[model samples]
Target chain A: MNVLVQGVLLGGFYALLACGLSLMFGVMRIINLAHGDIAVIGAYLVWVLVNQTSMPPWLAALLVLPIMWVAGYVMYVLLLERSRRAGQLVPLLTTFGLAIVIENVLLQIFSPDDHSLLSSTGTLATSSISFGGLTISIFGMLTLATAVVVLIGLQFFLSRTTSGRQMRATAEDPDVAELVGINARAVYAKATAIAVAIAGLGGIFLAIRQTFNPSTGPTQLIFAFEAVVIGGFGSPWGTLLGGIVLGVAQVIGAQVNPQYFVLFGHLVFLAVLASPRGGLLSRRGRTV
Target chain B: MIRARGGQLSGGFRVQRWTRLSVVSAAVTVAVIVVLAVVPFLFGADVTEQLTSLLIFVILAVMWNALAGYGGLISVGQQAFIGLGAYGTIFLTQHGIAPYEAMILAGLGAGAVAVPTSLIMLRLRGGQFAIGMWVVAEVFGILVTLDAGLGGGTGISLNGLDVFAPGYRQAYTFWVTLACTTVLLGLVFFLLRRRIGTSLQAVLDDEEAAASLGVNVVRSKRVLFVVAAVGCGIAGALYLANTLFIQTTSVFGVQWTAYMLFMVLVGGLGTFEGPIIGAIIFYLIQAQFGDSGAWYFVGLGATAIAFALFLPHGIWGAVDRRLQLRLLPVGYTLRKLDTPASAGADPAATDT
Candidate 1:
């Protein structure tokens, strides 16, 4: 039961990391390989703010969110947009290059030392709440709550708001959306902005709960990517469930043998990929 | 669609495959090979070591070109095979086998493993495929760490190679790697020269259209994927033979893929000569700035992005545009016939 609780809580973090990736792919058919690195950058920004200004981590996080949003918007316009015009695969390669650049730059600046948001958060990071015969870390619960709130808010935004609807319309068919006076480029930029901001949120949460270094980005990316895949592509709520599944599988795998935790998660992802129910992505290579 | 067969002029035009330029290029290639083969006799361990690294990069660049450039599959997980090749050699050496023979077997073993993995990996398209391959590498890395015999992440070095003196061992390693490089290069050249090459081009253009035209898109991709795995696996084993170490972190590093990407993109994507040039340039850069660490990687990453964005065709592509040279002639070129009758046949022909 404890394992199950821990797993679900862990799933919340994965869901948080994955939502931005899902959103980017859903809106632009882009898989931003640098998604994890962007999240790390957010964390680093918040860290710098907290360290230099002696500001509260929460306030630092609040300040970083808008900055990340602006960064995302600009990044899309300047880098991704041009690469997209180049070719389908160019964006992916460009993002990978971006990831490498971000990681190494972080390393250069931070000097590979591990940092945790717990230092600024006092004892809140370790504090836990007992409920239904299970004790859970408050930080973990906070991350889960944030994930649920973000997903619900995103759902509402996409379904109800005019801008969100425009974004969806653009995603459905950019040409038709453009025909209808919707600026697809602007819509894409907005979507990218939202996605990247959310990724920053995930990063801030991750820093509170775990230690991170510059190289943490790739592992985070794999987990988030796995969640996206396991949940099925382009679905937000499904991503949450997928995250839970992955988290639970990993926790359970850890229970069996600590070393197999990550390996088991990868195996589960491969299993999901191999399963016939994988749908659109798995059914690819029809020409083969 | 018209392939030049070289040897004779057609329609009073010299639209042939093997031109004098090709012959000169071939001579240059052979001369380079001869020099490489005798490097141990001329230089110390350091030169041979650096040359071996160059050869490994060339193998990686060429194989990556085959996979992403020609096969239309961009994989970041090729390190899985490289890791396997490195660890497989260690595993075999621990089992009382000769390290030299183990390297070959390990490479072949990685290739054999690729056939099954491709079924799982090839399902993904575009970016998913790219990261999915990375996940596969992670999985392989974790699996290696699980077995105690494999060093459980601490990693092991090649045993049973102590019988060879340092000089002979270095020479043997260089020779074996050289031989493998030649064969793999030949294999890629051979594969590209066949009808499969055309089918691969068709698939790269439009998979559905290629399939409609009877091109086996899946087969072409799978073949290239497996070949890449084999090449990388061999490179890994060769790397092990050179360094005498086999650590999961280093062997399965993403930097290997980055190097491959740098070579392919910087030289020229989807071109035979491009990767070779890219690898050489990359080697030179590494030799110069390799010890600078993080800043070096930053520069590399920035350069790669610049190339991907602005010069998508890369350095070789720019040069080829001006020179119109085809050293390997894997691609076709169309030229007008020199005969007056052929010129007269075209009403809109320009008079020069």
Candidate 2:
């Protein structure tokens, strides 16, 4: 039962990382291979804000989120828009290039030293609450709550807001969306911005959870991918479910042997991928 | 039957398989191979080692091109096979097999692993397949790390090569590398000359259309995927032999994929000779600025991006467009019959 609770909390973190990826693919039809690197960059930004200005990590994250949002919009317009014109393969290669560039740039700046955001958070890093023969990290519970709230907010926005409708329209059919004066380009840019902002938030959560370095992006990428795949691609709610499943699998595997933690998660992902329905929750069947 | 400037024609045009230029190019390729085969005797171990690295790069670029360019199966997880081969080589060596023989067996072992992986991997398309492959590679690396016999994360070294003297080992490694590279290249070239080549090209152009037209898309893709895995595995095994050390981090690094992408993209995708040209250029650049560290990768990434966007066809494509040179032409071209009357006309008129 304790393991299940911990797994659920871990799943929340994975969901936070993956929802942005789901959103980007939902709208743009392109998987940002550099998604994790962008998140890493956001983490570094927050790190610098906390260290250099001596500001609180939460406040630094708030400042960096808006910056990431704007950067995502500009990046979509400048880099992806043009590269996507060439062909399907080019855009993927472009994102890969971006990933390499971002990772190496981080290495160049940070010198490959491991940094943890929790180091600056005093007792908040280790503080936990006990209930019914179970103990949970305060940060972990907070992350789960935050993930739930964010997903609820996103669900609301997608259903109710005008901008969200426009994003949906574009995602459904860009040509038709443009025909209806929805400004699909603008909608895509908006979607990118939202996705990137959320990715930044995920990065902050990741940094608080564990130590990170420049090369850490790819591993994060695989985890997010596993979550997205496990949840079923192109579905936001599915991402959450997928994350939880992955987290649970990982936790259970770790119980057997510590070395099996990541291996177990990966095996579960592969099993899901090999499944006839593509995912446990996906009714659409074999999207990838 | 009409006689064109080059060959006999069934109609007004002739379907030419080989041009005068192609014949010359083939001769030059043979001459170069002869020279390369004799490099161990002509130079020291350093030069032989450098040439071996070049051969491995060429092998990687060619294999990647065969998969991505011709088969439209862009995979970023090829390092899984490389790491497997490296460890497999060490495993075989520990089992009392000769290191040289172990490398070859390891490559085959990687190909065997690729068979099952392609079933799962081929289900994905475009970006999903690319990242899916990466996931596979990560899983393989973690699995290796779990095994203590493989040295966990640090990895192991091939230990059976001490019987041969240093110079003889160097010469033997060079010869094996040369033979492997040549055979692989020949296999790709031979495949391209067969009817399966056209089916692959059709698949690359459009999968559904090719499928509707009766092409075995999955089989062709599987063939290429398995072949590429074997090629990368051999490269990995050779790397271990050359350095006498194999590590999880080094063998399974994504840098190998990046190199493959750079070579294939910069050379010209879908062209037989493009990867060779790209590999040579990459070798030159690495020789010059390899020590620049992160900046070097940044530069490489940037260059690959630039080529992917602005120069999608790459350097060879530009040259091929202007010169109409197919140094190793696999596809047939139809040319108008150039009779004595049309000989004095514009040279462009000779090609229909």
Candidate 3:
């Protein structure tokens, strides 16, 4: 039961990691192989702010979010926008290339050693609450709460706001949206901005929860991608469910044997692929 | 439509598929092959080893081009088959099979595994397919790590090759590498010349139209996948033969796909001459900068991105367009006579 609870909390972190990926794919039809790397960049930014400037971790996260948003906007405008028109494979390869560049650059700057934001988080990293033979780490609960808030907040913004509707309009049919005077490029830029801001927030949570390195981005990407796929590609809430499923599977697999943990998540993902519905909660069969 | 020429109507016009450039290129290619075949006798062991690596890379690039450039299945996980091939060779050699025979079986083994893998992987489209392949490769990597006999996370070396003299092994491996490159290139060329090649082109251009036109999209993709797997598998076995060592991380690394992508994109995607040119370009680049650590990868990734964005057709494509060169001339091109009547007519009007 404790393992399952811990797994659910872990799922929240995975969901947070995957939401930006899901948003980018939903709005722009880009898989964004660099998503995880960019998230790591966000974490590194926070690390710099906290350690170099001696700022509080929360304050560092707060400052870094806008920077990440602008970075995301620039990344989309400069790199992805051009490749998006080339072909289906071009954007993917472009992002993959970008991922390599980002990872290696990070490696060069930070070296291959691991780093953590735990020290910056003060007692938040060690705090926990006990109830009915179950102890929940305060950081874990905070991550889960943040995930719920972000998901609900995004859902509301998308369904209610004017710019959000415009983003949706652009996603559905770019030409139609253009004909309707929606400024598809602007919508894309904003969508990328929000997606990246969310990823930055997730990165902070990730750094607090675990140690990270330059090379960890690929593994993070694999986990987030598995969550996105298992949750169904486009749906945001489904991503949370998918993350939980993956998290639970890993925990159970660990319970059986530690080596099987990651393998179990992959097996569940493959099983989902083999199913008739394609994903656990996907509405449509085609990915786009 | 018949053209009246010199008071006589001509009903037939010749369609020239082969250009002078193609003929010259073919002659040059044969000459190069002849030279490569005799290289072992002329060069020392180190040079032979380098050439063998080059050949293996060429095989990989060509097969990858055939799969992605032609078949439109941009897989990022071909390393899976490469790893499988190496492990397969290791397993077979551990049982006392000849290393050369084990290499062939490794190719077959990879192809056989690809059959079922394609069934699941082919269900994805475009980017999903690419990521799905990466996942499958990850799964394969993990599975290899779980097997204790396979050295788990660490790796093993081929043991039986010690029976042969080092010089003999080097020469034999070089010959086999050359032969594999020839067979893979020949297979791609053969496929391109047949109707299947045209169908593949049609499918790549537009899947819906090709399916409507009776192209078996799934089956063609499956064939390409299996063929590519076999090629990579063979190359993987040769890689072990050359190094006599295999590790999970090095063999199953994503760096292989990065190199493949860089080569294909820089050379030209979807062109026969492109992979050859790309492989040579990549070999040259690697030779110069491969020892530079992370900077090499940074440069490789930057090059791939630059090519993807600006030079999507690659170097050969740019040259082909500028010079109207058709080195492999697999598609038909109708050339018109200098007569005024044929001057603005449709190029496809000529049929013979």
Candidate 4:
């Protein structure tokens, strides 16, 4: 039960990691293999805020969100606008290139070392509550709560807000949306920005949970990939569910053999693929 | 493999004789093979070894080109077969089989392995398909490391090659590599000239439309995947033959897959000569500047970004447009006669 509870908490964080990746895929149909590498940039942004100012984590995280959002927008204008250019930057090609550049950038700046973000709010991460013999970290709760709130906010933004509907409309029919006077490029840019904004939040969670170095970012992309695949592409709630399952698998695997944590996650990942219907959760719609 | 269907080159005048130009081409190939075969005795042993490795990479790149450019299946995990092929040959040699025999086994073994990987992984489409295959390659790497029979962290070594003389072994490896690369290039060219290759192009252009056209999409793709793996397997065996060793990191080095993909992409994938051209250029670049480490990757990354952003067609694609010459023509085009002789001369003559 304790393992299960802890697993669930860890899953919450994985869900957070996956949401941005899934969202990007949903709207733009871009893999953004550089997604986690971009998150690494966000992590460093918070690192700078925390180290130079020694600011609290939450405050630093909050401060960096707008900046990260802008970075996301710039990335959109520069990278995502040209679909042909986007295609040329296939996962193995351009994303691999981005990984090298970002990792090296972090390495050069941070000197290939691990850095930490001290608690932003007093004991925010350390604080925990006990329930039924399982002690749950408050930051874990924070992560879970953040996921729900942000998801709900995102959902509301997508379904109710004018820009959100424009996003959906553009994703559905970019040419048609352009005909109607909605800027398809801006919609893509906005959706990409929202994805990166969530990634910034994920970066904070990453710093809180583990010691990170420059090269540690790509694995986040891998983990998110597994979650997204399991969740079915473009489904937000499914991404959350996929994250939790991956988290539980990792924890349980480590319990069996600590070295097996990654392998265990991969096993479950393969199992998900081995299933007769891969990405079983995506509600089949008419192909665009 | 170029497989032309339904049309004999309508007899033209002197120009139509291009089909018989194979005599000149095959002569040159034979001459090159003869030189390469004797080169161990002619050139210093060190250069021979380096050239052998280059040949191995060239073959692997060609295989990658076939899979990506011709078949339209972009797999980022091809290193799985490469590592498996290298290991397969090593294991066979450990059991006292000859090196050449081991290479044949490796080709078949690679196809065998691709079967399950394809069944499990080919289901993924688009970017997900590509990434999923890459992770699966990592899984194979991990599995190999855990297996004690394969020497765990310290991988098993190829032993039976000691039966051959050292110079003989190096020379033999070089010849085999050259021969394999030639055969692979030939096979790819032959396929591209066929109906099956056209089906592949159709699939790449539009999967569903190809299906609607009565193409047996899945089987054709799987067969090409298996064939590509076999070619890669041959390259892997030759690689081990040159080095006489294997390790998980060195054998299944993820970077090798990246290297092959870059060769195909930067050289204008789908063009037979493109990968060959890319591999040579890549070798020159790496030999000259690869020691820069992370900076080398940075430069490579920048190059990829530049190409992806600006020159998606690559060097060959550009040259193809400007010159309109195809040494390995995968698609067809209409042409006009240049001479009055074309009106009544040998109909195939106009094809030239």
Candidate 5:
């Protein structure tokens, strides 16, 4: 029972990791191979702020969010926008190049050593609540709450707000959106910014959960990608469900043997791939 | 068939498939291959090792180019095959097969794996296919790591290589690499000359159009995927032979795909000579800055970005445009008639 609960909470974190990826792909039709690296960079930013300025983790994350948003905007304007016109492969390669640069840059700066933000969190790192013969980490509860809040908030924003509707419009058809008086480029940039900011939040949760190094991006990417694929690509709520499925699988695999944890998740992903329906939550036969 | 008259029907012009430049390029290529084949005899172990590595990179770049450049399948999971090949060779040699012979078997083994892998991987398109390939690679990496006989994560070395002297081993490995590079390139060249190559180009240009025009898009893509897997597998075996070591992390690393991408994109895509130029340029760059650690990757990534943005067609594309050069002429160019007499004098050309 405790393992199941823990798995669900862990799923919340995985959902966070995947949300930005889902959002970016939903809006821009880009796979963004650098998505994981950018999240790592966000975590690094939080680490730098908390360590260098002696700020609280939450405070550092708060400050880092808008910065990441701007970073995303700048990345789009400087690199992705230009490559978008070249070909389908160009933008993917551009992001790949950016990932390599970010990871190597992080390695150069951090020296490949694992760093965790848990040190500064003190009680938050250790505190847990017990209920009905099961214990849950307080941080895990907070992560779950954050993920729910973010998902609902994004759902509302996309469905209700003007900018959100614009984003949806652009996502459905960029040229059509432009024809309907929506600035597709602006919508894309805004969507990217939001995606990056959310990824920054995911990064904070990741730092709190485990030790990470520069090279950890690719592993995180695989997990996030699996979660997204399982949930159904480009579906927000589906992403949350996918994360839970992946987390549960990993936890169950861990119960059998620690080595089987990641392997089981991969096996599940492959099974999903082989399924006739495509994915668990895929809406249409064609993916975003 | 001999109709002789006035200006209407005098003679026929012969279509030329081989240009003077192509002949010269072919001769130069053969000369280079001869020199490369004899490198181990002329130089010491270090130079031999470097040349072998270069040849391996060439093989990888060429194979990647064939898949992505011509077939339009931009897979990031080719490292999966590379790892499989290395592990396959290691497995074979452990079973008493000669190391040199095991390399060939390893390639076949990789191709065998690719057959089933393509069934799943080929169902995806565009970016989905790219990420799907990555997932497959991750799966392969984990499975390899889980196997206890393969030494798990710590990896294993090729033990049977010690049967030969160090000099003989180095030379033999170099010769194997040379043969692999020659055969792989020769295969690609021959494929481009065949009708299947034209179909591949058609598929790359537009899958729907090709499908409508009766091109077997699925078969062509599968063939390209298998060929690339075989080439990468052989490269992987050569890599293990040279280093005599195999690790899941190093062999199955995404860095291999990164290098392949950098080489193909920076050199030029969809050109026979592009990957060769790209691989040489990459070797030169790596030789100079490889020891710089992370900075080397940063430089490579930055260069790839710059090329993708500013020089989308790559170095060869620019060179080809400026010099009007085609090292391997797969496309036909109609010769213009310089005189009115020449226009009506070619009845055979009119039929073609």
Candidate 6:
């Protein structure tokens, strides 16, 4: 029971990390292989902000969000925007190559080393609550709470905001969106930026929890991929469930033998692949 | 139809068509090999060794072309089997089999491994197939990396291979690579001409339509998958012979996949002439700026993006379309469709 409880809390962080990725993938149909790397870049940004500005983590993240948004937008314009019209192979290979370049560049600049940020007392990320015998870490709990909150906000934004409806419309059919006078390009740009900003926050939370380096991106990317695959492609709520499953799997595997951490993750991925549809999530949501 | 297209050649190069091109290509390839064969005697040990490296690269590129271009499999994971083949050869030679003999055997073994591996994986289609192959490669890398005797992460050396004396090794490596390339290319042409080739081409054009035509899509794909594994296996053995070792990082390097994709795509996909053209062009790119680090990969990516967008037919694809060149001679040629009737005056003469 304790293991399940602790695992569920940790699963919340995975949900946070995976949501931004799945959202971007959900809307754009682009994998954005640069996703984890971009997140790492955000982590570094938060690191600099904290060290340089004496700002709180939450406030510093607000400062970092626009920068990440621009970075994502620029990356989209220069790399991903036109890629939409290209064949499937084009986006897959180009993004992979871009991932390699970004990771290596980060390595060269940061020296393949790992670092973390110094947070103040009661930051909620590191604090935990103990009720009865099972103890829930505060940061893990906060990340979970934040995930639910942000998801609800995103759901509201998508449902209530005109821009969000435009995004959903473009995602459904780019050609049709053009007929309705919605600029598909602008929609894609905004969605990518939003997804990237979420990724930024997710990365910061991740860095707070673990020791990360440039090489860390691949594993996290794979984890998010598993969530996206298992959750199905387009459902944010499904992604949360998927993240919890992956998180619990890891925790349970660690209980048996820590040596099998990666192997377990891979096994789950293989199972996901073996499913009838391969992707558990549907491409769209509706009664039809 | 054959005569009509053959007649367009006013020069000797086109005079005999198949017979002449075969004779000419064989002559040119042999000439090049023979000259490179004696390079150790002409220049020095170092240059001979470098030439061997280039030949090994050419073999790898051509193998990638078979899987990607001919089969339309587009695997970014040839390194999976390449790494397996290298370690297989290294482990075999450690027990006293001659490296050359083991290299051939290793290729056969890898082909045997490939058929079933591809069967399990063939369920995946398109982007799923592409990423699945990479995932499979990572699995192989991890499993191999856990082996203690194979040196694990530290890797193993070809001190295990005692096939030839040190003095003659590099030159021998060069000849073996050339021979492998020749044989692989020969096998490619043979496969392409078979009924199997037609079926495979049909599948590439449209899977459902091909299946409806009674093409055994599964068998064709499996055979090509196995053959490509054999080709990659031999290339891996050759790479080991040249470098004299198999480090986990080097043998399983993603760079091999990158280079292979770069060569095949940049040169051309789905055409025989493309991979070869790509290898030469890639060699030139490496010679010029390979030492510049990740920028070259970025540039390669940019080039692939440009080709995928505008020139998706690839360099050879472009040249083949624009200039009507079929240097590799894999596909059969018919007379021009617009050509007015000549001696036969048959309307079907213009049919492709």
Specify the CAPRI tier of model 5. medium
Over 4 Å off, model 5: A285-288, B1-17, B334-352
TM-score of chain B of each: 0.93, 0.94, 0.92, 0.87, 0.91, 0.87
Of 2 and 6, the candidate ahead on TM-score is 2
Steric clash pairs (candidate 2): none
* TM-scores of the models, in the order given: 0.95, 0.95, 0.95, 0.90, 0.94, 0.85
Error of 5 at A241 (Å): 0.9
Candidate 1, residues B1-352, lDDT tens digits: the string is 5545643445554445565787799889888889899999999978888888899999999999898888888888889999999998988888878888888899989999999999988888999899999999999988898888888888787877678998888888999999999999989988987888888988888899999988888888888888888899999999999999778888988988888888888998888899999999999999899999998998888888999899887888777767777788676655556577876654221110
Q: In candidate 4, what are the lDDT values of residues B1-352, reduced to their tens digit?
A: 2223324334331222123334465576678778777788888778889899778778888888887777767777788888878888877776877879888788789888888888877777767767787787777777888777777768777787787888777877787887787777788777766677778888887889999989988877887888888888788788888888788977776677668866777777777667877888788888988887667766666676666566665788778767665554456543434467565533321121
What local distance difference test score does each model get? 0.87, 0.86, 0.87, 0.76, 0.86, 0.73
What does candidate 3's lDDT look like per residue over B10-114, in tens digits? 543455666677789889888999999998899898999999999998999998999899899998899999999999998888788888999999989999999
Interface RMSD of each: 0.7, 0.8, 0.8, 2.5, 1.0, 2.6
Clashes of each: 2, 0, 0, 28, 0, 5
A108: Cα error in model 6, Å: 3.3
Model 3 chain A: weakest 10-residue lDDT segment is A279-288
Write one digit per residue (lDDT tens) for candidate 6, span A172-254. 78899999899989988888888888888888887778777876775676677667666666677877777777777778877
Could you tell me which residue pairs clash in candidate 6?
A: A125-A139, A127-A138, A128-A138, A232-A281, B69-B270
- Per-residue lDDT over A1-288 for candidate 4, one digit per residue giving the tens place of the 0 to 100 score: 877777788878888888788787777777777777777787888888887898777788899899989988987787667643345335445666666677777777787777766444467767889987888888888888888788778888888989988888887888899999999878888888988989988987888777788877767888888888877677778787888888888899889977678788888888888887676476675111
- What TM-score, to 2 decimal places, does chain A of model 2 have? 0.97
List the candidate 1 regions with Cα displacement exceeding 4 Å. Answer: A279-288, B1-16, B341-352
lDDT of 5 by residue, A1-288 (tens): 888988888888889888888888888878788888888998999999999999999999989999999999998889878887787778878888898999999999999999999899898977999999999999988988898898898899998999998888888888999998999888888888888898888888889889989988877777888899889787778888898888889999999999889888888888888888667999883333
Worst 10 residues of 3 chain B by lDDT: B1-10
Best by DockQ: 1
Worst ten in a row by lDDT for model 6 chain A:
A279-288
Better of 2 and 3 by lDDT: 3
